[model samples]
Target: MKINQYIRQAQYKKGFASIILIGVIVLVALGGYFTLKAKQKSSPEQTSTTATDQKVYTISDTNKSTTNQLIAESKIIESLKTNWQSIQALIPFRPGHPGTVAWLSPYSVQFIGKNNLLVGFEDGYNPGVAVLNFNNDQFKILETFKNQAVFTFSDWQSLINKYGNSSYPVSTYTVSLLRNKQIVSFQDLINVPENIFLKNY
Candidate 1:
């Protein structure tokens, strides 16, 4: 009777050990499953954020690859020559108007991509630049700057960054050229001391 009791006790302990092992295995499996499910749920959100962060700038509706800068500039020059009256009328401070301190004229013309003409103007005192788009038998001014806005390097950088749509950014090369021309025009006025100072009698 004592041996039989001992045998029964040993069997009971073995059965308890088996149940504990099975519970541990089940808990581990459940933890792994939940971890995998969490990763799957977060993957799409991560992908969506990446897509939004990567905004791409592109050249639109122009022969960027084939258009020569010189030839494109010529076209803008011809257009300006032919439509000088109408174009000047569209600008502020017309040459003959009262209180007009500046006479605006196209100082520099560059052919950037997207049928856009980057033009610089001088008004004797202040220099300005504009990006003109030719469409439907007319020229439209897309962007314009005058005075300190066109004079400083910081403003130039800001204009380069801000002068375009979300899809099409302005060309930095053309903006640099326009800035250089405006600076030269400004220098032409200031570099002459006689013009700025009264003549000694």
Candidate 2:
């Protein structure tokens, strides 16, 4: 009888221990699930938000990336201002078609379009080209010209002639590219049907 009682008590204790082990496992699982949910709730959304929210203010692999980007943009803007001022002052070349806006031309010597002053030479601006907003006046200059990149008006006109009306006697693409302190032939305004160079006007 004593042996049976001892056996019964041993079985009970084993059952109780098994129950406690299962309870501990279940509690740990539940706790882990809640912890994961809390972590997800604390995470920030990287996308699926408005542009203002999703816009990256700065991008850099190292520290001071924002500062470097701002400095780069500022330098480009200053170059643009200087070029605009030069065009107005006629530093090296005189305005080819002054007093009357040309709007387009194809001579290698460089000619201001009849529409330059008519539109104040503000053809249109892209990411590389910046239009100043200080005095509500539009201005343009090559942002990457100093890197030896070129934007030729003749090339632009050729494309326009090939893809566009192909008329020999028509308006010239009123565009210019600036690089390395001089006008470049990398990008200029051209009148393509798709407006590859001449867009945003």
Candidate 3:
């Protein structure tokens, strides 16, 4: 009777040990599955964050480039103003002309380049455009379109097409220059098409 009881106790201990081992294996497998799932979910979020950071950096670089370009353009304009003042002092006046007579029309000043200015003058005899080189202190006549004709808008376009190759031609009614305080006239003006001029002057 005593031997039979010991055999039964040993069998019960063996069954309990098997149950504990199976439970430990199941827990370890579940832990590994949940850890893998977490890593997969976080990968996409990390990629999204990296892309957003790159876009922000690209925009910042573009803004900085535009700001630098604007600053450079401002400096160029200021330098042109200073050069204009020096050129104004060099214009020669006629011997008998009074101080009231302007050497060149202020309204007719046009900037062709950084150091080049196109000035118009009318002295009751000659009406023409003069090109001034600020760098070399030189001046030369560009052209005298008409003696005394009705210069319409079309005529101005023709002048630009023939000589200037300018994208923007001056308006018709705008005064070119003055002769003894009188507005210079354009007579027998030629006709030209307006389509040749560029849209953005």
User: Which residue segments of model 2 deviate by more than 4 Å?
Assistant: 43-64, 67-201
Ordering by lDDT: 1, 3, 2
TM-score of each: 0.40, 0.25, 0.27
Q: What is the lDDT of residue 11 in candidate 2?
A: 100
Assess candidate 2 and give its lDDT: 0.35
* Residue lDDT tens for model 1, 46-99: 444334323222333464432343334445566775785677566654344457
lDDT of 2 by residue, 1-201 (tens): 999999999999999999999999999999999999865552121112222122335544663544453443334334444455444332222334345332222111111222111112321221221112222233432112111112355754643343334432222222343323544231323221122233231
Model 3 score (lDDT): 0.43
- RMSD list, candidates in order: 24.2, 21.7, 28.8
Order of the predicted models by TM-score, top scorer first:
1, 3, 2
Whose lDDT is greatest here? Answer: 1
Model 3: worst 10 consecutive residues (lDDT sum): 187-196
Which pairs of residues collide in candidate 1? none
